[model samples]
Target: MITLAEAREAYRGYAPTYDLLFGPLLQRARRRAIRAANDRPGQRVLEIGVGTGLSLPYYRPDVRLVGIDVSAEMLAKAEARARRCGLAERCQFQLMSAEAMAFADDSFDLVVALFVASTVQDLGRFGAEIGRVCRPQGRIMLVNHFSTPAGLSARLDRQLSRFAGSLGFEPYFPLDRFLAETGLRVTASAPAGLFGRLRLIEAGKG
Candidate 1:
């Protein structure tokens, strides 16, 4: 399991070059995630593990956006990006954990967690926190590069699992297991990234 400490340390190092390294390569998937949100005007949206806020500009200016991240260094960049993108008025950044968000029940209309499921220490807690903050019937979107079930890639991922802790993410987390652990009512899934290796899972809260 990837601990909060490990994730913070890993992202601290990635903060400076995060946009450069992940920006273009992951841009397509990021776009897919934002589009899937289908946010409306005046809606409150929560983005967990918002990273450098590369997806901030894509959100509608009319929507209220709150982005939370565990890493201070990354959040600083995200805040700076929000300012640069002129999103400061509609966007808010906070240093928060996905497992324990600082929000009231049913606080948001939508929650987006892109590339975050594999990084958290406990999927169940993360999912529970998400469900609690989201209004009943609210939407949740998660985009991640999940490993295949039975393939050469799956074996390679298992072998790499030993090193995943240090890397700050699990390489072998399955889609079905995530649903079971999170207890989310998934509605649809769309292909993202190259060869559909990245998945955008859309769900609803009860």
Candidate 2:
């Protein structure tokens, strides 16, 4: 496995081309994630690993948005997007790691993380931190790819994990089990593709 620092450095290089490469798919996923979040107006929202602010446009105008990512370069893109979307006043971006967030307990009503679990070096710690910062009964909306059961696709996914890692992608997670282990109660889950290539998980902190 690659070190977190190495992964961060690799992503810095990809920041420029990241949106161009996955922008469409990512936008679709973000829409799905936001719909699953069921966010109401005036809710406090926190998004982890908010690369390029792809989800910013979907957020309700009345909701206060806070975004954090480990990559400053990525955050810069997100900031620019927020500005372009005329959401600069409603949203705030910060440089922070998912494993150790610097926020008060029970700070947010809704926490979102899209396509982020696979890249985390410590899944357990990341989940725990998410739980820690979220208020009781706070919703957590996630869109991620994970290892599927046995099949040709699974084999291909495993093979691709190698290249993905080299490119700073963590594209597989046991999301259901991870949430359970982290004490999150999953309220709903749906596969984003016919082959279960991506999943949308909606849960609440217990």
Each prediction's TM-score against the native? 0.96, 0.91
Least accurate 10 contiguous residues by lDDT in model 2: 170-179
- lDDT by residue for model 1 (48-159), tens: 9999998887888787999999999999999999999888988888999999988999999999998999999998999899999999978888898888888998899899
The digit string of per-residue lDDT tens for model 2 on 133-180 reads: 889978888888777666776787667767665767754445555665
Highest TM-score: give the candidate number. Answer: 1
lDDT, candidates in the order shown = 0.89, 0.80
For model 2, how many clashes? 1
Candidate 1 lDDT for residue 21: 85
Angstrom error at residue 162, model 2: 3.4
